[model samples]
Target: MKDLYHPAEPSLFTGRESANRAYLHENIRTVDLRSESTPPTGKVPALFGYACDEGVRRNLGRPGAAEGPRAFRRGLGKLPWLQEAPDGLADAGDIRLDTDRLESAQQAFSEGIAQLLRSGYFPIGIGGGHDIAFAHYKGVRTYLPTGRKLGIVNFDAHFDLRSPGDAPHSGSPFFQIARTCEQEGFGFHYACIGVRRDANPQVLWDRAKELSVLTVAREELLGSALQASLKKLKTFLKRVDAVYLTIDLDGFSSAYAPGVSAASPMGYSPWEMMPLLDAVLGCGKLVSMDLAELNPAFDTDGQTAALAGSLVHRVLHYPGLF
Candidate 1:
């Protein structure tokens, strides 16, 4: 059976040049417990994916999230080449998820990430929803057992800190991570950038303040220069050992990114937002990244996906201090 979601085509971005897959496959490796085989070996970074579309809505008998991984792969495949490198890169393929088992799905996703980290590979997750953040954090925590403090810089219109309940939805990831870290005696710092003033509740704001989270409101974001915001964010990240970046496409204005699960009228333009990411890349310790909420059904001309793909390229291509 041919896998519809095959590893990325080496020639897609490499053009007529000698493909990197042969070299990468020999050097990069994956331990397949199912087949009882040793992992592959390569220098190219492995792109591990989790296409989760399961959540409360799906659990309630709505559409399943099986399409997320494919949609994101489509976007990624369409990305333009930015820089040249000798290393080969390939998608490690999606982590299979059970829609009916949320906790189990989270555990599976987390373990996949832990495995990738252990192999010294960078993992770029494509979301089924923002709730995947919890799994990403879990992976980071599991891999970094040295007690290194980690910080999160989330770019979203919603705060995503809703109280824990029987069901975990996309709107409750940050809260779940925060609460989990608190219970486990870990230092987790959170900074919410590009937040919509009206989207968050008073209680959420009070909690953020109490936790000393650096909340940058949309109004403040629009008012101040991007350089200023970058400066402020850099200072915050400096206090932490490593950083995980989660960018929710809804943080971009509807005109800029109309494909998001929740589009907002007042948000940053693509040009306005890219610099912030550039600033984050400058920080040098960007451990992992997840770009979420891109609903292609609402997109026109594939612009949103293209924009997202470009950002992913930038994240991978950008030079760093590390």
Candidate 2:
């Protein structure tokens, strides 16, 4: 495997080191997407994992998320399979962000996503914030011909359907996406999984119902295992041409993933969530994926990053098991 670290930083974490070499090496790939060079196109479909840490901690009006891509890369460096996989995987790197020009940054990110799709590559976006989902969805739209609907599988604790106002933050992605679909006359079928009743706002719930979106609450999902929920998801996927998967870390309980901005005390366990991912991959038309809301500041140990890294590895390696 190639060395993916900068000469200036040789240590992993905030100087903390672990012996999980597979976690650091096997399932990781890196790229600097900010470069002007175009991505190469080839036969076997390519998978580009993007780490965009632009708006990561913007709710606090601070910077540091720019390091998100590198941090995740370092964690992945310790994983071995990522390095050994024969699959066509590349790191598209992080989008450069100008703190003062957020809209421009978003446009750039959206364009990067579009380029990947046009080149016929599957994109797995990592971090920054849930807000990036809007741009990701927009990129997918470019690939769809007229009259095609896009299916979305959002696994998160919150609905993320907050009203989109002048400055749409991370919490307002779904609202923007729904609005876009309505205005453009593009059909969208969205299924929200792992929602906590207490976290969803009334307006969002009303909108979800009005749109005929299928929402599987946490209580209902916890009552059954991941396989059962996935069985239900397959029915939803059949209605659309392509699928986009978004995973907010908060969907997992605090015990399993405490490194998210909105940690939930009761959420899915790793054992439970893996099967859902497996089922989504089985759908065979996964266009793009986003894993968001990972706040390293809140992590006790490196457990959250390790778990996320493992989940990513599984999603990339295991295509389908229907």
Task: Residues 228-315, candidate 1: write the lDDT tens digits.
Answer: 7877888888888888888887788888887766777788776766666677778877777777766666676766677677776666
* RMSD of candidates 1 onward, in order: 4.6, 5.4
Error of 2 at 16 (Å): 16
Model 2 misplaced regions, further than 4 Å: 1-66, 82-88, 98-100, 224-228, 320-322
Q: For candidate 1, what is the total of clashing residue pairs?
A: 11
CA lDDT of 187 in candidate 2? 74
What TM-score should be assigned to candidate 1? 0.83
Candidate 1 runs further than 4 Å off: 1-43, 56-66, 84-86, 223-225
Tens-digit per-residue lDDT, 176-208, candidate 2: 888888898877588888888788778888988
> Candidate 1's error at 97, in angstroms?
3.4
Reference-based lDDT, each prediction = 0.67, 0.65
Question: Each candidate's TM vs. the true structure?
Answer: 0.83, 0.81
lDDT of 1: 0.67
